[model samples]
Target: MYAIERFESRCKKAIESILKRSVELEVPPPEIGALFALPCHGLSKYPEELAGELASKLESLDIDLVGKIEARGAYVNFFPSGEFYEIVLREILQKGDDYGSGEKKDEVIVIDFSSPNVAKPMSVGHLRSTIIGQSLYNILTFLGYKCIGDNHLGDWGTQFGALLAAFELWGNEEELESDPIRHLFELYVKFHRESEKNERLEELAREKFRLLESGSEREKELWKRFVDLSLREFQRIYDLLGVKFDYVLGESFYYSRAKRLVQRALEQGIAKISKGVVVIPLEEFGLPPLVIQKSDETTLYSTRDLATIEYRLEEFSPSKMIYVVGAEQKLYFKQLFAAARKLGFNCNFVHVDFGLVTIGGEKMSTRRGKVVLLEDLLREAIAKAKQVIEERNPLLQNSDEIAKIVGIGAVIFNDLKGDRIQQVDFDLNRMLNFEGDSCPYVQYAYVRGRSILRTAGVTKVTLESVELLSDYEKKLIELLSFFPRIVKLAAETLKPHYIAQYLLDLAESFNSFYTHCRVIGSPNEATRLAIVSATTHVLKSGLSLLNIRAPEMM
Candidate 1:
């Protein structure tokens, strides 16, 4: 247990004992359970005379670990002793890399994210689900939950039907073989354009999809080719981002299972054919009806999604299944979840929806080919990172490697630094800027701390060498004490932005300490160096949880 946690526990025990003996209260109010709540403030639930007595009793307790306790009318404030800081620092040094890790949890959690559709090039719009999902995986794993990062690929849909129809109409064999994904993407865009003019194209596309679902060998072979080509291209982007998934289950993987699932739903009277389309009416759940199968008998995403929930439950029996999707699909997920309940699979379904990513204030649209491809954005960012490195540190070795780290890290940090539900506008210059609340700024702080540690040559720090702290030291220590809590909070809330904001604050605090305090030549050199050492470890660990690299020097 951390020093602050232990102290808080002791205070709670003391307060409970005091209230039980003096106030004759059988049950403590919820406020009393809050951290650092004024004892007398919650005691006001009782009579005024009794609350005063309880406060007086708390002040007279024989505990000195807190150093002092004062009762100011309807409030009691306790100040932690100096030994608290010493123990916290000692424990941090003792734990080192394992400071914020929690005990193993006996529950499994499945995270489904980064599911870009096959044949569509990954774009800036895909950034949030990919990195956010990876970050949540890191945090939950650190907190000891058995996390399964599943990349649920979008390989089956009406969109693919359109792509197939387009390819058969105008696709060139040499063009497709030379550049499969781009060729397929252009064909998809063309299908939508042509269908807008001639409605017959829409019917043709639906028939092609129906043929594909009915196992036409030709259509199946073409679908496999698209899947193979798209996955290879997607892997390159995943490699550059340093993301990995335990499973890459596409919608096709669940398509056949969805047929059986829909049959079962029909047998159970959970669904019915309405106007030749199968749907589950969910008015009681405050959601619109969920379409399971189209009028042409081709399955929809809802059918596959329910199958996904069923498969995950029977396979992993996860305590929770999180879908990291865009905010536009909020209603779709609600309908899916409600349909799942109707189907009698009662698993925890969470939709972690995030706002859309716009490029220069324009919403990305693949149908119009107006989206910025993720591969292009990454390459441009890395090139710009190389240019900045050359200008800042001409003598730096392995600058290429460092630029990738900084550039990619900046893009990821920008995505995570704001609220998940807020729209993210891409601006590489702002993200890579080293002077503000960007990844480079935080990385630079880490580099500076590392330089200080290397110069000090202090391999270890002990409580014996530490003494009284100045305001700067005290501020840093107080901030450091919150690291463990911050990590746990990020895990619980499923928000990586909390960790991002915390790192920015820590970097700002460390910079302040560096400016106002002397370390190497000061009389409290060992003490200040300890602070620097701990800060670096935390900065590195926090960045790692966000799936960002912390370079030694940037």
Candidate 2:
């Protein structure tokens, strides 16, 4: 158990014994300087009376972890013992990388994110879903939840028909071989532009899509090539981002199952036919009706999504299904979840909705060719990071590798540092600033801690020799002890930004300690060395939860 857990348990026991009743306690913030809260349901009218009674009872208890117990109104607050720092520090050093991790839960979780469309390059808009989903996966897995990341690829739809039509009209084998995604996107753009001038081209594209869906050999072959080429390009980006999906199930994977799902829904009366179209009427639930099939009897996105839910439940039996999507799709998920519940799915469903990522106050639009490619963004970030590395530490070896880590880490950190639902503007200048709440800043703190440990050259830490630690040391230890709690909160709230902010706080604490305290040749060198080592481990582990790398030298 963690030191805080032990403290909470002992405090609860003490309260229970004193009041002769079961009590639940909560840990307040550090600045509040209160460690526990006791409900005074029966004594609300006499809060001071309850406070006096509990204070007397707490004083009589034989608790060593708490040095002082005070009554504030109807609540009793417990303060940690002077020796708490020693206990927490020793535990941190002993646990090392596993200091803040929790025990495994006996449930599986499914996460759907980064579902880029086929024959299209990933744009900046996809970054939020990818990085946020990856971070949540990391945090939940760290907390011992069985996590399954599914890249629900958008490999089906009328868009593919447009691509096939354009390719048949003007595709070049050599151009496609040189750059598949770019060539395919150019063809897609051309199709839309021509269709704007020639309305018949739209019908032709729809015909091509219908043929593809009906499994025409020629259309199927073209569709397969588009999916294959798109996946290859996506794989390159995923590799750079260090993202891996357990299931890369695309919309086409559900094409066969969608008809069955619609039939089941119709049979179960979950869906109804109206005006030659099939939909689930959610008007009573104050939501738009969910369309399952078009007037032509062709399936829609909702149909595929419903099929996906059915398939996932049958395959994984997940305790929770989380969709990491933009907030604009709020109503879509609401209707989907409601339909699933109405269809008798007895499981948790959540939509982890995030705000938009804009550039210069304008939303990204791939159709208008006014968008930033994720690959281009990453390469530019790497290049800028290389410039910084050369200026700061030209003598550093493997500079390119370090630049990659720092550059990518900066982008990820900037994305995750804000609340998940808050809108974020992509500003390269601000994100790469090493002096702010960026990944580079926290990483540099980790490097500083490592440098201290290396310079100290201490192999062992003696607890007895570590007495009467300085104020900064105490603050650092206090912050370190809160790591497990922070991890738990992040997992419970499904907020990766909590971990990111916690890391920034821990980094700041360590920096203050480094600035104020000496470790290399001090009287408490061994003790300080132990603190430095523990801080380094924690920073690395915390950064890893956000799916950001912490370079030892940077």
Best-matching candidate per lDDT: 2
Estimate TM-scores for all models.
Answer: 0.92, 0.93
Native-referenced Cα lDDT, model 1: 0.84
Model 1 residue 144 distance off true place after TM-score fit, in angstroms: 0.4
Cα misplacement distance, residue 395 of candidate 2 (Å): 0.8
RMSD of each: 4.0, 2.5
Q: Give lDDT per model, in order.
A: 0.84, 0.86
Question: Candidate 1 — which pairs collide?
Answer: none
What digit string (tens of lDDT, one per residue) describes model 1 on residues 225-259? Answer: 99999999999999999999999999999999999
Local lDDT at 132 for model 1: 94
Worst 10 residues of 2 by lDDT: 458-467
Residue pairs whose backbone atoms clash in candidate 2: none
**Per-residue alpha-carbon lDDT of model 2 for 114-205, expressed as tens digits?**
99999999988999999999999998998899999999999988788788888999999999999999998888877888888999888887
lDDT of 2 at 68: 80
